[model samples]
Target: MRGFSLLDSSGLPVAKTCFDPANIPEALHLDVWRQASRCGAQVDSLQRDWRFRGRTSNWYTDGVVFSHTLCDATHYQRTPRHIRRGDSDCLVLKLQLAGHQQGIFGDFDHFSSPPGTLVLQDWAIPYNITTTPYEVMAVSIPRYLLRGSHLMYRRNPVITWQPDSPQARLLVPILTQTLKSLATASAGEADAYAAGITGLLDGLLLGDRELLQSKYRERDRLEDMRQYLSRHLSDPDLGADHLCRQFHCSRATVYRLFQREGGIATFILRQRLQRCMQEISRMGVVQKGFLEALAHTWGFSSRANLARHFKAYYGITPQQAVEAARSHQNEGQREMNAPYWRDAYRVSRWLESIAPGASPTEPAGAHGGARQGPRELAGH
Candidate 1:
């Protein structure tokens, strides 16, 4: 990190450093590591080519943000075990300017991010990063600063921008200019400036709502599928393949839709258990062990299986739910009714009617249905 600091007289707030394997001495490499260690990052490898050259400029904005630019020929960097454990509170948004880089973080496999890519790297996890000849502008801001942003919940590393995409053509230049302006501003104004930068970043991460919704039709389809499943919870054969056929989507699409919910089968099981609870609350002890019959109607294979899933999901047994319902009735209170199954069933039938005799792997709504485009797939 090398940049002139506005704060502190000892060049403590800003540092600008350069490295050239061709001419710079070995001691400079040691000095680079020392500077990196102070900031909780490490440079694990340098390109062997004598042509390798790099520059790092770091600016400390007190506690607002730590900004740095790393321009280099090629390198491999890593957050060592001890460093990750000790400095696990910040997040880095690295914008690629030149060549491509690839890395693995958390559950994601190696992701190859090209230029114009904005990657959010978590300091809490160790990552193995390899970059080709590239120049990157990185902003280190506390995880707390972005805690509530949509990017925080995306659970992915990269936000790619195609060369001709609106974000790439328009937003990229805006961001670049903003960063440049921030570089010259006084330290006292860092917080205000940082906030603006973050706001712009949020906008870049989550574009206009209607447009975003139109682009990510998969999300819409998933929501529709959830509603459809809720209605057909009573169908014993209602499962992933059933959902695929009903939604006119493939097995992969169905799996991807419910990936976060533990897959389509798990989602269906949970919905069935939830519906059973509704019925239990509505019917109460009047239909003793009627809970088991309801379970059968809702696709659970047996009473024991229903109890297992019920207890796991609700932290209570079906019998316990019945007791709670009875107690509520005694107190002259009522559990809110779930959506009418008849309506859901009708909607399910309608959707099937529209798609009619569709193959399991065919995309739903593709025949005459509108779908999201490339823009919807652009964010974190």
Candidate 2:
């Protein structure tokens, strides 16, 4: 597939990329589709015996990713591996146009999304979903874009608006029409449509009072617990029982509050590992017994214990993490000097001619063709 870019009215580039399995050999269809969709989650055919056929068109503009997909029944999962890699940080809003889907999303129990339902998912959380042969249009907005919005602060990461609900009734048609129009829209028209859709979404999410006062109170309590945990992370006894006593809640209440994070124990362990990584990065050198001291400071029993958990959580040993951090710092320094060398090289020939001194050779261009700046879609 070739990528192409279009300049919108403001001269900003809008990129689009597409994938279709029709022209490819049937045997490679699923593999190709999996590769195309790997950016968001792991996908697999759900049928016992099936031949897959699917198409996806994605447009990227202003840090938002808009996509339309039509595919066979498939299973999609965002596992802890995907979360640790930190690639799927967007909040996805999917409009289910046809077929049905059932999934476990964040703290929500198993739920079904019927036709015309708008499903919102925070990609930071893990999910497991399986869909019947379906057609859907989705928009992925960066989390930073909604950082301070009320929607992000909600306790639940997954939400849905049923087809008959007022919110869905108001949004469904506009979203469907906009996506259809984008398929054949000019650059300027697409930009205008995208902007309007974004504005509508912002208004809907921020102005909706679907969350009751009781929900807000629960969210506040949950946040308070989280702050307390952060403050006392080094306390070796920090667990459900400790949290329960400190927050004056029952064990069940504490556990339920952190259920989405895989229970309080998992949450606390992850926090300690993360804090250990931060501390390691700040220390310029790993001194003798540093790992052992750091392990004790972060509530780990010993260096070996810390290494085992760190490797399991982050896919790297603590020492390797320190080495990687130092390597990254060196790479950053090199990057800081790169522009100066590039500028000097650009004028090397003139300097040599004027002063008869040795001059740096210019680097060859990496490619010889029209530069590919943005992604491409099927039509435009």
Candidate 3:
């Protein structure tokens, strides 16, 4: 919606950069930079969608942020020199949408960067290049975000990720397609576009980390609340309906999200008895008083009810469960005694949020079906 001005390739928009190519001039117009200079003498004229280019002769670092764009069937050359020092310690993370590029990072090595190829090389460093007629897109990003790429990779560059990695394939498309549709800003719009560039860069390096972070946060929040409930199950008010009221969610929504294994009441009862067994076993001796006390505390009205459910869930009577727990040092049988039965509820709730009423082609994994609790839990 907002326009951000960025310099782009003169002819068909090809080349290199650190700034926003999306905010540059339209590929057909070519007004971002008035002229192309091989080393300030303007050796190579901006070929009208054809010819070759070079690296930057004199690179400025600390003060100015450097960036450029190159399009298909074009090349801009710069004079080569041994890069000594400058504020720009970063390298170019170039994406090859079409054609093959030959880059000389330190020694001459042919870099066949093909379409969807992502390569990294230093700018404040030094390099030379001989080109063929092909379309290429690149960005001169800040060095800090590239991990060890700043100091370790100038002379000997490496392919951190292949086009085949799930992350690379997912992100490269977004970058290349947007650059190919480059456009200049409407004046005074640079600030907005700069912000967008930050977002785009984050998407590239982070690989949906931000998105996954939120999902973990959601799981943590729910886990914190669930753990707290283990202590107060005896309070009949511990069911999902009550939790919904406390958490300010509707009854149906709470049931759908938090009780997939069984309804809220069932999960609460199970966790309560399991906790009771744990407390009973910790005394190091199986006793009826200890068992009954914990069972009632967790809201089991009578010892009989607790024993019935405990036996059904864990295949053990209260007396036997306590003995087993004590032997394990108060550790309850989590494999079958915990609230696992409730997971289907949470997963179903997760799916509903992303694609309500739609059948998921991919089911959750062995634990709960999805790798992360629920499929929709990704963007949490």
Candidate 4:
């Protein structure tokens, strides 16, 4: 409790050390890769001030207390490959001890926090954060701990509440003490403690039944907005006013929900661009018709307007994206055919070994003698 120490999942104590980038060895990249892998994301250090100190008190629960000065870095959660490989569905609660950070989640709303702010992040969605040099006490809560929270439906993945509030004022100290005391708790004991911990969190988050109901309503409205946008991506008339009329919500309420993603218009434009990119990547621009017509279908005024916004958003023109998609598809095809090509070569070698006169390119029924060659090769 006096100095930085770590307890493994098995309750073994570990010494702590500082990882300073200035003095890092060549293997530092691999170490960073492994750390990111364990944290269930891909990490890129954008700033040179990379200094991290961490201690995993419970590996079984992925609980840790870490402090770092990892400036200008982003962690990606829902990339296709990352999802295919699978991710540990967990929630991270970060108690900022010093400095501040900004996080983007839930349809691109950006939230910023200073010291004494508790931030919640879900591991299943795509979000990014840029932090100033800061110290934080981070606790990892297993997905099961967040059961009944209906986290998936909650559009605001990064929720920040300041510890200065009366409830947080009492809850923060209790949580800190509980975590420190349970640092050595056994696996079974940890599970028991986690229930109590989750109870505290439920109290902190819900506060009262009315507040819980409000959150549910907000979540439903967010989902409704997303659904409406998807269904009417081609409707140029769709905008903040249309959303307010459709959902029967006030303009203010709609704006607040989408503030992090710019405004309602920006959100719609972003979605349209995203949809266009997906279609272009799959069918290519050729199948999607003229860029101007494609733009009209997705609500853009003209091809030039679409091209201007698309380049601004993605840093590339629609034509470039099509080329990239083609390249990616080609690479995928090559990978898929590599094994088949190797097997064919092996089969040809076997046929030649069995019957010298046999042609590798010939079909199995090309010759009576060659037909027997496969049987002889199978025997060998």
Candidate 5:
């Protein structure tokens, strides 16, 4: 279509760190948050230029992250850092459009992901990514939505390639075409179309297994990797090599899976940090010795590394995260959290509900207790 445009207008753009770059490296900090209020979710994004790696990344920050990417010939890897620390159990689904993609989420691996590959991967921990030619479509949906949202395991990648399947071939292309058309429709129609694509993908991943099992091998492998990550967190050599061995895949294969995601070592450290974060949230901020030992026991080697990684992952140090947790419990961080979690529509509903006339108590002369015995109740 001519002059296709699909930019969200509720917020501004920013070139900021991915997490809190003061705590991370400059390269990894290549991110900026932009306000977006298009979808029903409290939407926003943190985008970055990936020319060095020859790529572009637009990480949606709110409801399922919807990313549209483009690039020339380039080597790209996106190892996302957690903007909020702690144990977050969510699923992510990546739909490819133009180029090939490869990813290693946990123990599962995708060597060459071509168009129509719906990669249902886990985001509870860290993973490495590589995208080629460089255009890809991705949407990150929370696992809770898939318990029944649309049948497409919103929490997993339903990547498939079955040459014999006509239905999958026909519909996947239609969905992609519709999404592209969304770019050219009336702004309102575009938004609706975008919304519809999200619905279609959600269903595909969570439902329609008759057409989803072509890549069942990858799905089973993913389950294995998730098990390995949690079960072997204590093993110091539990990263790339170990993962490669467990998957019975080559080292080169492993590297491609992780790409530049700080390599396998970084993934291991991040997972350990994530566990500590969960403990911090559950057991409170008091430095329990076992918890401190737990850090070293998991390969942190020292508390400093533990603290540093924690801050980088969550944008706040352990202590700060704990404090933020407490404050969040008290509805204090709503000042920041509300802006990120509640989309325009939800916020509007909130504003309308609590706007000047909002009240919890009943109105005067309402049905609930209208003078329990008004003159009509004289018989009482």
Candidate 6:
């Protein structure tokens, strides 16, 4: 195969590199093969008596790495050390064009992929696999680019869809055609193809019921907690324990739900500060006593304490924010009528619609109904 290089739209080099065992003497083939696959996994053809013949072509772009390979039976293993090396944090999707493969991924989660099948592997986990002489087209996508959560892969890192499976039927032909076309594609075209493939994979994966349900539960719980916090922002006892009691969940659950927001306490403080800012902006040219009252209502000890945190978070004092709001009243009014503010208004209206004492267990519309346990809230 011929090799070429071109600059992508972003000015990064897009290159296609090829490796053929036939180009080199037989004695050096194993060493070269080992080196080439090292970044992904440890591979050995010794079980086939090291009489290996293979050729691979790889296309590298900004979004993904695509490779086509024809190789003899080989063993591949990724262990803790390989994961720790952090050479690749990609989710690999391999479409089997010929032959069969099987693997034990992430603590004996076994899966098989036959010709015309598509297999997924999360490189963050350890795996062991052996394959018969096979021809495959594989794409490696950075984990961050994909939708949904990585937590879904922790227990079951390897997944396979048979030739007749819906996912395989939809993806296999498109992937084959795209990989074949990459050889002649311009840099701009290559990037577009890569992005298209990544988007398809994201849609496919997000369709998994397990992933969708898990995400829904988490999102619902977080939204519920946020609504509760918004209503109770003026309450001095609103904290993790209070959330646990109100939601009928453990303290750890509350903490984990807000972990991304820098813990429950921080989220509450930030919300309170935001409320204070909104109040000050609305009041305009407030007195010292009013500032103190606003601070106290939002759980701050004094105006001075609120000012310290407000400046730290927003990079300006409360007084300055008030002045700025006054000067830009018309602009602020226009912004308040924008789509984003409209959405926020709708959300606030929805929050107000919920009863103040309603818990997650109650039917969303009314104050009283069947009570659900934390497990139900988690969607398990």
- Displacement of the residue 278 alpha carbon in candidate 3, Å: 76
Candidate 5 stretches with Cα past 4 Å from truth are 1-151, 154-214, 244-249, 256-262, 285-291, 329-380
lDDT of 5 by residue, 72-142 (tens): 22222222333122122234445666766554443333334567665555444344443344465554444
Please report, in order, the local distance difference test score of every candidate based on alpha carbons: 0.49, 0.61, 0.40, 0.51, 0.41, 0.63
lDDT tens digits, residue span 252-347, model 3: 766665553356665566566445533543455654577667667778778788888866654457676444334333222233221221222222
lDDT minimum window of 10 residues, candidate 3: 355-364
Candidate 2 Cα outliers beyond 4 Å, as residue runs: 1-14, 48-54, 107-109, 147-150, 212-380
lDDT of 1 by residue, 1-380 (tens): 11223343333222122333444343233333333343343332223221233544444343333343443322233345534333324456677777767654432323456787766665555454545567777665444344223333223333445657665565466556646765555544544455656556556545644324543566557667877877777787887888878878789888887886667776777567545754664564656568668778988888888989877655457776566445433322222131222222222222112111111122222233221111211111
lDDT of 4: 0.51
Order of candidate numbers by TM-score, starting with the best: 2, 6, 4, 1, 5, 3
Q: Return model 4's CA RMSD, one decimal.
A: 17.3
Q: List the candidates' TM-scores in order.
A: 0.44, 0.54, 0.33, 0.51, 0.38, 0.52
lDDT tens readout by residue for model 2, 204-305:
766667642337777678878877887888888888887778889899899888886677887778777766765765574778888899999988878899
Q: What's the C-alpha lDDT at position 99 in model 1?
A: 77
RMSD of each: 23.0, 15.7, 28.0, 17.3, 15.5, 24.1
Candidate number with greatest TM-score: 2
In angstroms, the error of model 5 at 286 is: 2.4
Query: Which has the greatest lDDT?
Result: 6
Off by over 4 Å in 6: 1-13, 46-54, 149-151, 214-380
Clashes of each: 6, 5, 30, 2, 16, 0
